[model samples]
Target: MSAVAHAQGHAGQGSQALAPADPLPITGGTFKPTADSLKTYQTPAWFRDAKFGIWAHWGPQAVPRSGDWYARFMYVPGHPHYAHHLKHYGHPSERGYKDILPLWKAEKFDPEALMDLYVAAGAKYFVSMGVHHDNFDLWKSRHHRWNALAMGPRRDIVGAWRDAARRRGMRFGVSEHLGASHNWFYPSHQYDQFWPKMGADYDGADPQYADLYHPKHDEPFKGNPDTWYTTDPAFHKIWFNRIRDLVDSYEPDLLYSDGGLPFGEVGRSLVAHYYNSSIAKHGGVDVVYNCKALGSGEFYPEACVQDVERGVMSGINPLPWQTDTSNGDWFFTDGDTYKTAPDVIRMLADIVSKNGNLLLNVALYPEGNLPPESQTLLSELAHWMGTNAEAIHGTRPWAVYGEGPTETTAGAFKESAAYTAQDIRFTTKGDALYAITLGEPRGRVTIAALGRNAGHERRAVQSVRLLGVAEPLQFQQTDAALVIDLPARMPTRHASAFRIAFGA
Candidate 1:
């Protein structure tokens, strides 16, 4: 459980130096539990059943649609966002992320109302921002001076969302992007690649914002030697301290680290503390710990989940994992376009079929409230979720996910060209099978993977019902596949779910 950074030493270079002390060992047991021990974590049947979760990428960063971490943007010189920053707020020397905090008035933010809409839209769980790389705590923090309570929204953002989500009978969680904050804010170097032509020494002369964007030193970046940022011990200590405060304060049921866990023994200790504390509360209640780079072969055996950013894995595994994405940019902008409801639904179906969950999706909005277009998309998703709740909410993958000509890679951040109507993702609930169509069929649909003539010869069509439709539809099994007559109009516009009952 050591948070040792994986070092790739050059031929001439000596081995990397170890941290002063070893990481705190994971307590209670050494044999990391597998999927069989999931019950010990108290991962509810509902969560395993509910394959989809929603994330609120909300933060002061959302106040500026220009990009993801405005904290880092202000530091790099001559980047597009840096120029944007210079145009809007003064230069990085005069105005910093700390200054932007006050402008983040969540005046239109209504957690209860928003949670109701999200749940109705089929989000079984909600993850509020605990802290991002900006180093600003979303909740009222006992340790951090920079937080939502003292400045910005002047409200306990995460606490309010947690309370609202719990009240709505939905699981509540918190996301911590603080792991990358240490290197991300490395004072001596401008880490952004977008401004390579501007040179790295641009921020060195800024004395006014030295504390906000720490002053750089002569040393090389510790994490990656070739990188510009330095992993100074003092800065790492501060990062760990802030994260410790976050874990102790919120005790979120699910904790998601932006990248991986922080970079040392301190990070391991923090993880151990989070797990142990959750166990102490609610009598050993299980919780999920999500991260991207868990380190090769260094997996958390205690029901911890891995998150793939903006992509789906090809092969299905019994272990539960998640995928985080957004409809558009992570931050909201005036002219930003968003994904249509159909696109979102299709993505969800494909992900579920691959045995993964979707998280960290935000319908970007300004002034802390969703726009009318985003609201319309959520309403459409709600309609789809209502009709296909059986297929989506509590289902497991069948023997084979489905028969489809199209393929989506299991790599990180992979995007699909387009899904054809012929593609169908499969999930199972009890004795019934749910075939989710990726897109609307032009006319007749046939699944080649199911086997031609096999549907009519061996598989009997017991009953076929289109999701969201009141009337049961008749279907005939042919040599190719089960073909059900479609209504003149689609039940739900985006992707449709069909509940096929089978004899036990």
Candidate 2:
């Protein structure tokens, strides 16, 4: 039988059956599951060149409309999600998250329309959530019965998204937060400590729901970020099997792991298959795998680009990386504040200038449609990207990322740094250098990195022009700074880009 068909067979098996502890051997490829063999992998140009991507971090969790990790926290007493669930749906013992599954009728879901908006907003790629920490799959799953196709949307959400993205001439990706879900969902196994439902076990405590909640474990979920992974051999095999199924089924251009390469060999084996399968399918090593740092000692940067959650790199990194963050709460929450167009544009400039891609998540309502506010935000993003995307896509970092008074904190998990008019980020494309200002400029803008004495510039600047404007702006390059006169009226609000061309 064919490889994909063989995979479908394994996936079609009941979820109660587990794969062997030692995952199947590496698929047909030069790379093995070991760290040494996988070191040969490289970041694909498609991903590096596609500086910005949009992610649909949507799933059954959005059904609550309470924001991120609602399924787990809803079972934890004293948590806001618990209070919300209590007030709206009754106690967890009677109405568990499994009940929330059928309520997520994505009737208004229009992936094609959303893809058009994302492409227009300068997103070169799109990501669909294959599975979230809620332990619910969003696609047509052969392994799990509680999936979008069978329960909620009754649609192949991932397949729909992948098809739309491919038709629009954009790369497609899938993110798996399932690795940490085994432990992340442990909260559901506990019983309420207080009141009417006191002593009544949450639905997760029942043996019947073990497949979804994960068999009651010794570890109780406390919502700790650092301690959300499991060492249990049984869970390791399950995670390995499920993720392998996802890779084989979709063959996404990019595969994202919510955490660092998990469970040692189990995780590595899955990545090996992902890479090898990409080679066989596409006839080239054109695929990308994204994950977070190990948060400690050495990590395999050569295997995959580091994925920073809701954060950024301090400066230009030699290896390509990514920042995955949502505009608002990861799930759709009513009345949640969102990032503005300027906020997203400014972040794209800084991230790209630092040799990183911005994988932004625009949360979707439970029905698979974007909120009206999100649509307006996308329109605003389209307008800005339409005017200044030349500075974004297919660009590389310059000598210094930028010269700015804004102090930047490096590493991962930090918020986007604030910037001033002086906070200019640099990117080079062919013969041109694009200097983008984070804040609006009044009269004149100076780029100190292009200065002679600053030791960053190589040749004399030939001409300088503001993007989205007609005429070239007058500029002077001196030992101290490269100064340019501003137009009487600004072309774009929040930020602007200056295209600087050097003499031959």
**Model-by-model lDDT, in order?**
0.67, 0.82
Off by over 4 Å in 2: 1-25, 220-226, 294-298
Among these predictions, the greatest TM-score belongs to 2
lDDT value, candidate 2, whole model: 0.82
What TM-score does prediction 1 earn?
Answer: 0.84
Give one digit per residue, the lDDT tens place, for model 2 in 7-39: 111111012222345547558686687788777
Per-model C-alpha RMSD: 5.3, 6.3
Residue pairs that clash (backbone atoms under 3 angstroms), model 1 = 41-286, 49-393, 65-332, 187-214, 187-216, 188-216, 221-229, 313-410, 452-479, 453-479
Listed in order, each prediction's TM-score against the native is 0.84, 0.93
